[model samples]
Target: MRIALLSYSTKPRGGVVHTLALAEALAALGEDVTVWTLGRGGDEGFFRAVDPAVHLRIVPFPDGPQNEGVGPRIIRSIAVLRDAFDPVAAKYDIVHAQDCISANAVLPSGRCIRTVHHLDQFTTPELAACHERAIVEPDAHVCVSRSVADELARGWGIKAEVIPNGVAYERFADTDPAARRAWKQRLGHYILTVGGIEPRKGSLDLLEAYALLRTKHPDPALVIAGGETLFDYRDYRARWEARAQELGVQPIVLGPVPDDDLPPLVAAADAFAFPSVKEGFGLAAMEALAAGTPLVVRDLPVLREVFADAARFAATPATLAEQLSAALTAADPRRQTAGRRLAAQHTWTEAARRHLDFYRRAGQR
Candidate 1:
């Protein structure tokens, strides 16, 4: 079957990563798959190289006005993508959208599938409308975790297919020793978190936790990486800076690291912290596990459902500090082994087969 997977941007966000990975896996299963995304900031390709078998259609979405607000930007984004995609929408056997904006862009066709990675409560009028329409209008839905699918059922009486994310286990598990040494040499012992400093990422909470961790153990510094996003969080960022200063903590914020360097950086970390307020799946935390690194994440239902006993859970900053501290010092070979085993089992091939099964069932309907 011919499939077109749509995502809003070519950035390193979770949904975009899922789109690319699933496309390649589907192609490997002898299906015709084409990945469609906006070439934001003139990005001609994805963050990492994709399999040559999958086709790509990077619709050039140039930046909007200098003073454009998030609402206007989102509206313009939908218009541009719709203009580029709607004309060709009829040819594909399946058009699956990965986010609200892409789902909205394909809304006119009334024949698209959606992957609701997670549900968010948006207050902005336009964004709230987009989010609601994206959820209600799709012909079918897929979610990365059972908790999220449960939310859809409770909120809208919608049932969705549950397809867990597949991790690139060997990419991180078999990272170059020299590359790991280089990150260790540069950053020393550090508690690393990906997805940058944002409200959803719980950046301020992590800062507070880091400060608390420093009171006893000052050996591990806080290193944050990967913050490329479409939303403007300058106000939140300013507040975070003030909190960091007030707590007497200075973290190394490496904005966006290269794709090739991510594995070694994760491998060299003392421990990985994922204190996000919301998440479909902790992809970065899973990568850390693939590298045999201890992980501490927020005590959310989705995380608990996905991670179980393979990771340490913390509900607040104080507990995050406590869990992070233990992760730094304590050595649980059983937990480490469990984490590696979990990461190894979630392969893209299995995810692809399940997706194909879902697609075929949908086609029959």
Candidate 2:
């Protein structure tokens, strides 16, 4: 089977990671897979992370900066659609689009599948229209989580199949003890949070929770690994830094660690905390689990679906802090065992096979 995975921008975001994982998984399963993405900076990096057998075709779109205003973004998305769908668009048996916002508008007119990542702040009226068109036109639709599928049914009256994202099993298998020690020596004893420092991600709430945690545990540092804020959410990074200073917490903001360094960083961290209020799927939490690290996650429905009985759930900042404290102090053998077992159940190979099955079924329809 030949597949064309369509995504507007394949940056270092979770959606991009999902697309790459599925593509590589399909390729590994003896399917001819080609990733069609908006030409972005981390294209080479993303491909390097995938299996070497997988093929990549980047379609560069003449779009404004990613942080541009809504008007320019819409115009740029239109331009992208025109360019991306003009040539060689109908060559594949399946065109799987990631994210319901942009890729939904530009897929070719055959067996197309749009994967809804989430429906939080990025869901605008234009995005809704694009998703509606895709739902009516495509042969099948997928959602990363049940919460997102339910939201699609409620908001746009479109039903979608649920397919959870998978993680690369080998990437987190067990770090070298020497390398782990070296990373600890370099970064110190720190609590790690990996994601963009934006408002919707609950970075401010994390800072508030971290401040409270610092009152009890002052020695461990807080290391936030992600890119600069790209949303219009009032510069939460600045506020976090100011609040951390006022509270006398040692906070280190490492803006987006390289892909090669992520595994070691995850292994070196004492614990992982993800206080996201909204997420279609919690990939970071999965990464932490894969690394045999314990996790404290927000009590969001999607997260609950992903973690199941593997993670400690907290609904608010205070509860989050309490959970973090417990996670820090106690030896959670059950959580560690459960996390490793759950991580083992989700593999890129299995995910890719399921995707190929879906594509073949969609093509028949």
Candidate 3:
């Protein structure tokens, strides 16, 4: 099968990560897979090196004029991506889009499949339109979690197939002890969170929770890593910094960890924190599970659906702190074992087979 997978940016966002991994998995099945993406911020390639089996097409997209609003930038992004993606419709059997921007770009071309990772309410007019169109226009839709698929059905009256994300189980589960020790030496005992300090990530809430957590466990540090984003979060970040100062909490912020360094870093953490306000599959937390790290995630349906009894959950900052403290101090062995088992169950190879089956079904339609 000739499959063309499209993503908005070559960044380290969840959807982009899914696109790269899925493409490689499909290629491993002896299928012809090509990944199409916009190379924002002068990126020559994806954040990490992609497998040689999968073909890559990174479209150059330079920065726009200074002070360009998010709306204009989004419109420009659509135009640029649409202009670059011109695959022969007859050649490719499936053109699957991974995000709203990519879905919008491909919708007009006919019969594109979209994976709705999660539903978001965009304030920007252009982004709002793009999001709605992407949801409504795709020929078929898939969601990583049943909760998100239910949301799609409730809001748009559209039934979407549910196909959960696959994790790089062995990569994290088999992290070298020496490498993990190296990270432990560098960062000390810490509670770690990936995906950066953004609003949707519940950054401010985490700061509040960390502050409370410090009262009980002052020794462990709060470390944040991997925050590469397309939208401007300067205002939200400023507020977060101010609140951190007010709460007298100093968090160690490592901008973006290299691909090779990530597994050990995850393995070294005393506990992993995932307090996102929204999520599809909680992939990062799953990876933390693969590393045998105790996890404390936000109490959301999607997260509950994904993690189940494998993770500790919290709703508010106070509860979040309480949960983090418990996970850090004395994590349950049963939960740790369960988490590892859950992560190991979700393999890229299995996900690839399911995707191929979905493609065949979509083709029949």
Best by lDDT: 1
- Per-residue lDDT tens digits for candidate 1, residues 151-236, read 99999999999999999999999999999999999999999999999989999999999999998899898999999998889999
What clash pairs does model 1 have?
none
> For model 3, how does the per-residue alpha-carbon lDDT over 91-156 read when each residue is reduced to its tens digit?
688999998888888777778999999989999999999999999998999999999999999999
242-333: candidate 2 lDDT, tens digit per residue: 77788777678787777778888988898899988889888888989989887999998889888999999998889888998898899889
Which segments of model 2 are wrong by more than 4 Å?
A: 41-49, 61-70, 108-111, 122-137, 228-234
RMSD of each: 0.8, 2.7, 0.9
lDDT of each: 0.93, 0.76, 0.92
Pairwise lDDT winner, candidates 1 and 3: 1
- Shift of residue 99 alpha carbon in model 3, Å: 0.3
Q: Would you list the rank order by TM-score, best first?
A: 1, 3, 2
Instruction: Tell me the lDDT of candidate 1.
Output: 0.93
Q: Model 1 TM-score?
A: 0.99
For residue 101, model 1's alpha carbon misses the true position, in angstroms, by 0.6
**TM-score per model over all chains:** 0.99, 0.90, 0.98
